[model samples]
Target: MEELWGRRVLLTKQFSAVLDAYQTFPAMIDQGAYMRCTRCNTELLKTAILLPSGFYYCPSCIQMGRIDSSLQLIHQAEPANQTREVFLDWQGTLTPAQEEISIALCHSLAQKKPHLIHAVTGAGKTEILFEAIYRALKKGGRVALASPRVDVCLELYPRLQEVFPKETIALLYGGNEQKYTYTSLVICTTHQLLHFYHAFDFLIVDEVDSFPFQGDKKLAYAVSQATKEDSCLTYLTATPPQALLKEIQASFIISQLPARFHRRPLPEPEFIWWNHWAAHSKKGTHLGKLYQLIDQLSQKNHVLLFCPSIHLMDCLFQHVQKHFPDLQVEKVHADDDQRKEKVTKMRQHHYQLFLCTTILERGVTFENVSVIILGANHPVFTKATLVQISGRVDRKGAYNFGRVCFLYDEQTVAMKLALKEIKLNNQLARKRGLVDEL
Candidate 1:
């Protein structure tokens, strides 16, 4: 029973039968006059189905394991107190700027205040959270590190496990096989947070500005519900939305890391105009320039070609493969079943180039890689996305510089804004003496 703290399960007939007769209680799960799901707070009455036996069924969150009127949700109460030894085995040290921000973050967490870390890509944001997380765990508080992207969650799991080897750390995602356990720290996707209620004392949301978490209201509600009343919330992102910026200015404590952890400036994107690229692509003509760019990068360093849509990605993939028969090329998107394998292969240097959509724009890093935006003027490419895409280049210390090319028919506001933001961050880094003397 002590191990069931912070665990929830839908009380279906199948689950009811498994419970011991003495442990079964009437008030354990209740169905009120109005049908509503206790887990997701979804009004089941709106999407209810009346059965012949005169009961209602909810289909709203059925995909997450069904919860109907006849079924009740059993949420285990959090433990009152526990004694555990917590230690961090990591030996890496932070930069002076990062150390200052990390100390400030620890102070904010101690005060239980909301804070934001507006850092550039490759700023070692994950390392900055080590001290704060150590403090939280040492105090016997549960910590949750959530990200909007599964790729980010997957990337963070092993790193955190290595750092806190003695503590119980669980990684939760869509297709994970690991069973739910009462762990001191949990790393999960934002969608998985809907299953928890007042569970975490220290909640850190990485990539807070990324998709699904940025615009969706339900995920916002899930974040709010997952944290305790006095829990400290921290948001980590390279590009924060205007609303978050306003909140940072007015209420939240904010810290900024404009330079990469390696003390290198962000790679500024180069805009190259190619007239009638869409028409040429459709007619299968005027691909000489594109080929030349790819050829240049293929000889040295991996390349990531970003397309606006799946259709465009497929078209470009076909074009690139047709033109360069000997080069190793692959295509990946959100629906690709082999996305994980493909990404792993890319990291293993099995593929020379990859044509992909915005799915690869964030949370993945490739060393010695050059980036190319095929249609920089497309409306789908936002300023924040463009910055993230450009950030894919020159992330590792071994290769501290790479080209970021924006191949466009015409420059849009998003392109200019992304470039301007990169330049401004670089300038700030220089002013603070954070950048190398390049």
Candidate 2:
């Protein structure tokens, strides 16, 4: 009981003995029982399999560690009240737009209202949350910062740790080995929130437009279950969906930052028509234009070549290496074992050419990098993804301008929409004097 204080634990049939030893409650319905999940309110159905021991298991959240019948979830009832002297160590200053939104966000969190910060990429959205998070921690309130991608969590953990060094900050993921502790700050993937129960006083969902969390009802339910009833929730995203926008228009507190932290407009994507380029590339014919583009760009800038699929990325990587033997090139995807190491190497300027899929589209930044979206017409490349990929360029203050080229066999609605959105944001930024002179 002492060890379980201020922690939520998911038990299974295998832990029946432990349930008997401690105060326990059913985490899910028994097999064949007409009961809904107390947390997500998901009804038991055929998917809930009956085990050999006459118990039912929820298959809905099996990916988040299984929750079976006869298993009891044990949660410490009392608030942890584990407060500490939390201080912001970050020395950077937020832009005026960011400062205004940051103050409103802190007030909204105090009032337990839902808010959304619609900021473009490289807008210093993370820094804006420091004030709100600091206030939450200082008041003995637990806070959780969640994102759909583990890469986002990996990037945010160290930064948040540096900002609130005295607070216990826990980073949770699928295979994390860290034991659950009474921590004031928790940074984790959105999927990991399924394991939490009414735990946080404040919840911030970053990259709300990204995958696994964007349209996932289960993940959304998990987020609701994880936070307290009165806990404030803040969403941050560059491209918000229609539903979220409607919510913002109806009631949610809304804030917008169209310009980046460097006060530069987003790099508009240039459309390059290459008819049947994929077939020609596979045939090793009509390679002059691509080679010329690479040759010209590789002279001074790092190139991120976005392929539609992993197989295509590999094929393109081989062809590029064969053609440009002197150039440093590498391919990465979701399954790459050395993805972190490769990204580090890329940041260290070890590789001039990075060929990848949408996996490198968001939550990653490189200075003086130009983007090439091969097969931009592919159905997989959505408008939001293209915007994010284009936003990757011109991120650093030292080099706040770069090229974004979309190589497509045919013009796609998504591609056109992406370009138009970027232009509109830049126009708005300039009109508001949020951007520097073009």
Candidate 3:
């Protein structure tokens, strides 16, 4: 490996095209790694590169890494006293599995090693992120933890504020209305990442395979565009896509948590198919399951029912209200401004049942909550959604006897895939001794 000006000369890894450097030979290697010849895919021992820019290379299909090889003087932004992080770290206790994952992520960030973390539901993945966030802040490096939902940002804001008492932090998202400064750490949606141009030093994307981020190539592009050169990105997800799964299988680092932070087992979802499910109401059978499930649980506990659409959710709420008038039922959706009120009522125990769409699947956690997914076969229901919905129950042991059941006229391809992924992840974790095999 040789350095010209500030750029690195390598044959294997590819740097981004933004680097002005050019090379005549196929990609060259710094350490004998094969740099594929562009014209003929042949291996070349010597390579010529044009520079002034740090570094550049073709990873067969990608452009990545530093532009110049010269010693770099990194300028880190200092946050205001308000944004400055409090010295207190996560006081909430974590499981050994959680701690192991945290230690690995801290190491990865320090070494600039990229990774894909596939932990189980209720794995306390966010708490594991604390050490890495602290490392970045102490180094005065910019950091970002992005999710696809605003609710997640809202919930994470206070937690971040608690950790970084003196440090300033901003929450960004659609209609967020929060002002971001150069030095502030940020929690935001994938869309908000687009507003940043090479800004963050440490980027962590939660729910990497979740919708909008997973479905939209541009959102992924936005996340890449938001990071500074030489930045380290750690992706967090429960259900990684197929390509990522294969990559993790080959070399990517992974950590697994089969149990919630409370060490309670993740509930196994039973598929419920009623005879008149489709005949009476495409969604009615699902509603019936909810009614029955809630009735069973209401004798002692509260319940949450997930729906794929708002129209049907409203229908279920209206239908159940008459018989269960004694039970408080509420409907909440993305467009509903009364969401705070609805959530508050549920938390206050004013509402016994919540009929919601997929919006509630990921961020929110309720105590003693038993969850049921109505209309698992609904066209909008996807594999990620199903898993997230199932994740809602038994978290942190806020409840005992947690149950997550998927109600469907006929199970969709997505649900089956979800079940398969859940079992596969649990099996892998158990095989590695990360979690016990059921």
Candidate 4:
């Protein structure tokens, strides 16, 4: 029953006997030729998603588990809310601006209102969430901090554990092998929300604008379904997508933080025209500007070189190795089994040049690193993505500002917008006297 608490799960053979003793509801509702998954709100055509046993299943949320016609969902009652002696254990101080936002968040939590924290990169978003989370937990409310990126969940789990040592904090993701237990605090990927039904009383979604989750209806449905009707549902992001921005303007409470916690301006990108860069990299010839930029940046700081496409990253990786035979270099992409290991090594300063695609664009941080984006004009590099990639530089405030170069054959709207947004943040910071004069 502890395992089933706060969760709605399909009645498989393992749960058949246990659930039979309890109560259950249909996992999906039938509507003639179409059946809708109650968990993810995805409608599936019966003919299109027929199981081998002639059962109709939901293909949209199959990643969580098949919610078919034959199965019922069982939900055990959540244990009574339990208070803790100490809900928060942080010793850090927030800037006045951050304190204001944190107070706003706490108000939102108390009111159970939808809210958005529109902060610049490195604006201490996680810390801003701590006080609100503390208020919720102190009152014995169930809370979940979810992110679209698995890396974010992985990074945040340990921090939450450190801050809430007395509370049971569950870390849920696709790759995590830990058994689920009913917990007061849960740090999970957004996709993991599908298993729960009206569980969390305080739901905070970080990186709400990031990939896989962005524009994903199934994942959005997961967030809504996993939350209690009267819960505080807050979104945290450096760059809010347009659709989300509209929603914020229309109804949601908003808090904007324009400066990094370190009181430094975001590093603006330098757009350099490097004609025929990819073709030259593929031919292993005529890479004067590219070689020169790498040599210059790598001398003092680690360089994260971003290629718009994985194939382009591979081609560039080979030439980089040949051109700089003496320097240590590494590359990682979404399919790379060693992605996590490589990123760990990069953070330890093991590589001079780390090449990657958009997978490394956000949710991870490295100190004393500069960023280089190849093909910044490529269709794959959206304005939000470019902003996030540039944000990877100087996150720790090791320097007053970090170098970010976009080596593109042609400048793009995304490039311009990213630069404009960064500049706007810096202006706002300066206007507020949040950053030191250069």
Give the best candidate by TM-score.
4
What tens digits encode model 4's per-residue C-alpha lDDT throughout 190-246?
Answer: 999988887888999999999899989989988988888888999999999888898
Off by over 4 Å in 1: 13-37, 42-62
Alpha-carbon runs more than 4 Å astray in model 2? 1-7, 12-23, 30-41, 78-83
lDDT of 3 by residue, 1-438 (tens): 112211223333333332344332323334454343231123433244334464434332222232222322122222222233437555687677788888888887877767677777778787888888887777767788899887777777887888778766777777655544444478888766644555677898888777667766556676766676677788888777887677556555666555556644567678887544433443444455556777997776678878777776776677778759888788899899888668767767677888888888887767778887877887777888888888887676444776777778787899898888777766655565665433
| Index of the highest-lDDT prediction | 4
lDDT of 2 by residue, 106-213 (tens): 999879999999989888899999999998888888899999988788878888888877767889887777876666788999987876777788999999889989
Any runs in candidate 4 off by more than 4 Å, and if so which? 17-23
**What's model 1's TM-score?**
0.91
The sequence of per-residue lDDT tens digits that candidate 1 reaches over residues 128-211 is 999999989988889999998988987898889999988778898887878777787999999888777778889999999999
Supply every candidate's count of residue pairs whose N, Cα or C atoms clash at under 3 angstroms.
0, 0, 33, 0
Off by over 4 Å in 3: 1-86, 247-252, 276-290, 427-438
Candidate lDDT (C-alpha), each = 0.83, 0.82, 0.67, 0.87
TM-score, structure 4 vs. true = 0.96
- Candidate 3: C-alpha lDDT: 0.67
| Alpha carbon deviation, residue 256, candidate 4 (Å) | 0.2
The best-first sequence of candidates by TM-score reads: 4, 2, 1, 3
In candidate 1, position 371 carries an lDDT of: 90
Clashes of 4: 0
